[model samples]
Target chain A: MLTKRIIPCLDIKDGRTVKGINFVDLRDAGDPVELAEIYAKSGADELVFLDITATEQKRKTLAEMVRSVAEKVNIPFTVGGGISSIEDVDILLKNGADKVSVNSSAVKRPELINELSAKFGSQCITVAIDAKQVNGEWLVHLVGGKVPTDINLFQWAKEVEERGAGEILFTSMNNDGTKAGFANEALAVLSSELKIPIIASGGAGKIQHFTDVFLKGKADAALAASVFHFKEIEIKDLKEELRRNGVEVRL
Target chain B: MKIVIIDYGAGNIQSIKFAIKRLGFDAVLSSDAQEIKAADRVIFPGVGEAGSAMKMLKSTGLDKVIPELKQPVLGICLGMQLMCRHSEEGDTEGLGIFHADVVKFKTQLKVPQIGWNRIFNLKSELFEGIKEQEFVYLVHSYYVPECAETIASTEYGVEYTTAIQKDNFYGVQFHPEKSSDAGEKILENFLSSPSLLK
Candidate 1:
């Protein structure tokens, strides 16, 4: 049986973890690699490193971070943010990232997804859609949710799958940073609509939210940053909770 | 012990290398036929289209060298598929070591059955300490049908061979490097197995 995945995402800025991760064991909250190792120890099925670094020189620092993380972490690792071309994906993959997620760049040139997926297998390419409900319709957003596009979330999702994206990271911008819950309604629709695995991102507040996303939302995976970054929800405890709820998660 | 991972410009080679390194063994990633043949164990790992990968192997003359290898060779993911007799992916011809044909999954379920799946009815020293129905990660659209070479089987939509063994050759459809502790155990089993050591 394919077990439902639980992913922890870390936002990295200037080669350091952006958020003030307050885990007691994790003394250096600034180092992304240390944080990744901690998460893997906690039984995180996968880890996503979002290179929140803005400048060009700092992007190089992100690559260094990836190399460091890849060397120590044994689990599947994904790198995203500022990844636009095949070269960007190449740098990360060469550094041992198993998968690369593209968001803003993929939206600007939808063909970028095809290019990346073709050069690398679709299994290595992840298309992350940052969308928010507007006028009762989910609209794809770009530039870190600063601008909304005319593309419908469902239509873009279908296109990415057609273009050979192995997975879709659908982030509900409205629910982001809200700590309310995932956009289960939209995730449920996407689960039924797409053949590929849908990784539900954003609005993950508590352990029940993870359960809700998996059950009610029908998500193949649920990703959260702050919840896992802080000591609020330990991955080991969360997996135990999910198992108690009858979710087929690897324990 | 020397371990060489055949690199034909495929993805996920680094992770495999790191996985071996983590197991307290040095792994060399190379396309050199001599290094692969001389190594105590070889891991043929790939993640890409079947036809193109096979073409690269032939171009590098690895296709000829790989099948002739005496050391225990472990094929992973697409590497496993290429060891079969044939693959529906691009209608490509494989190395013919497994004596089975790889076919695409046609079902109501997804094409690439991604994530950790359980393997049961285990056989072979490759699964030495691993338990029945223990989870190993898998990410592939094509799979080899159950055959005499099959050492382990997994079901997504249909029963298929997830692990295979034929004399000195072994193959697994899952990415052992990325499958966590259970994955590590499988790698350790392959590395320390008496048959693999000269």
Candidate 2:
């Protein structure tokens, strides 16, 4: 009886939590470790900390932040963004990250997934695909959704699974900030096509969107940034609403 | 009491270290046979393929040392699978502490069953004070079938052995370190259970 997971993603910039986190405890939420503790207390099944910093010094800062979060938080958490080599994965996992999500680097070298899965099992690797619909066809985008590749979403997802990736985190660039709803149709296609779990990301606006992603999109987990960051949708209330809607969420 | 987590180039050892620290015990991560044998409690955790892991253990002489240990030894995930007689994964032979076989799930269900699932049929000191049907985090492709050595079982595609006990040795297919409060309690019981201490 594996239950669907609800994950709140925190973006890190210059070693601090980005995206003005507007919550009851504003002061404590400034620190990534403190915000992670808050989410762990609120019943977040898992957390994703994306280090959006681009500088080398800041990357070192992100590692320190990960270590601090690992000491305080007990639940499984993932660290992503700017992770290119096996060394990066080693540092993060050694710092207590359950899984590492790779988007741009994985797209560039498909064999990195194989190397990672062979060295540290597939369960430790998560391939995050950022896709944008171009003239009715989803194309894989890289460099934080600025550069687009000719790779098709479905075909690339299947390839990722074949390459021994444990899970796929599919983010829809079209619906990301729009927040009207998730890309349920594309998500359903991904769920049906792959044996590995699919995590729907980007456009999660309301509580209904969470339910829709699980029920309609058939996603195994739903990850959001601003909605949970800004406190527009509380994880506690959203999980309650999900359980009421007949989804098997951890209470 | 000193806790030693066996490190044979496996994944997620840090989380286990953190969990032990939270329980107010200092855990030492080591692959040295002397350190592992000297510890009061030894935790054997794995999150990789069985064949390669066993090869590392054999090369480092940990395979021989683990079974000879009289102290309480707990195997987690691939660690539990490696304690069995055999595994379908890589057709690899296990350490043979528990008389069981790890086989691949041959059902229509998903290959890698991931997430928190309830474990019932508790009958071991490892589950003391833990309620039946309490959820624990598990992420594995293969499972140990129910056998005489089984101490706790769970229903997924079918009823399978999620926990096992044989004298001083214990094994669990779930990740107790990552399983929130219920999981922490199991760790505490393993550290404090009187029967295990004896």
Candidate 3:
């Protein structure tokens, strides 16, 4: 049976974790690798290390930090941010990341997803959709939800999945930092539509948010950044709670 | 001792090398027969289609050399598939090192069974500290059915072989390098302990 995954995302800037309020103000969380090890020990289904600023100075430290994380833990970890080329995806996957989460770069070059999927297979490529609710409809946002694409979230998701995206990581920019809960309606709509696994990101405040995403949104995985990063809601405890709530957990 | 990974032009060799380096051991990427024969261990890792991989393997005569390898050999994913008797991907004949045939999962779920799945039925030294039904990351379209050499089994739509062991050859349907710590521990065990028969 396919178990639902709980992922903790870390926005790494210059080899350190920096959590921003709505992807704006960057504050150093801690060492990226150390934090990943903590999450791995805590029973995180997977870890996503987004070099949030990989374009600027974050490039140099990306491989080094990934190497450190690979050394410490033995779980599937994904690294995104500033991954523009197939080589970038190759380098990160080579650096111990199980999947490459492509956001901005992929939005710019949709062919990159098809190319990478062809070379590495869909299981290796994940298209992360950062969407913001605009005019009551989910609008796809790029450049960390700063720039809104004319493309609708559902349409784009369907296209990417057709192009062989193994999984979809959908984040709601509106409730990202709000931590109220996930955009269950949007996730449910997308999850039911795509045959591929859908990962609900953003707006994960408490343990029930994970349940809501799984049970209500029908997501295969739920991604939380601040909640898990801040250590407010431990991953292991959250999984147990979900299991009690009728979700199949590893433990 | 350095491990040589055979690059049959079908795999994520760079990642496998990175994985070996993470294990604190040096691994060299090579397709050359001489390099493979000289290495402490030979790693056959493949990611592409089976028939294409077989063509690439035969092109260098590595197919003949791989089966004759006296040193320990490990095949990952399609590399593992190639070690079997036959692969249904392209109706390609395998190296026949293991008495098994790789066939696609016939369930209505999907073609490629991607994501992580728990492994059980461990019967070999491949699993040292690893408990039964441990979750191992698996991404494969086809699987090698029940065989005498199956070391570990995983349940997907039905029970399938996750890892298999024969005399000097070992194959894992799941990517040990990609599976994480528990997966790495198994690799470390392989690097340390030789087959009991040897």
DockQ of 3: 0.43
The candidate scoring highest on DockQ is 1
Error of 2 at A147 (Å): 1.4
User: Fnat for model 3?
Assistant: 0.31
- Candidate 1: DockQ? 0.76
Q: Which structure is stronger by DockQ: 2 or 3?
A: 2
lDDT of each: 0.89, 0.90, 0.81
| Backbone clashes in model 2, listed as residue pairs | none
lDDT of 2 by residue, A23-88 (tens): 877577669988988888888888998888978696578778888888888788888997888989
Native interface contact recovery, model 2? 0.60
Q: Rank candidates by TM-score, best first.
A: 1, 2, 3
Better of 1 and 3 by DockQ: 1
Name model 3 segments beyond 4 Å from true: A20-29, A54-58, B9-11, B14-24, B90-93, B106-112
Compose the digit string of candidate 1's lDDT tens values, residues A1-251. 78899999988888888877887876787888788888887888899888877786865887788888888887888899988889888988988999999998987888998888888898888899999999999999998888989999999999999999999999999999999999999999998998999999999888999999999999998999988877788888999999999898988
Q: How well does each candidate reproduce the native contacts, as fnat?
A: 0.65, 0.60, 0.31
- Which regions of candidate 2 deviate over 4 angstroms? none
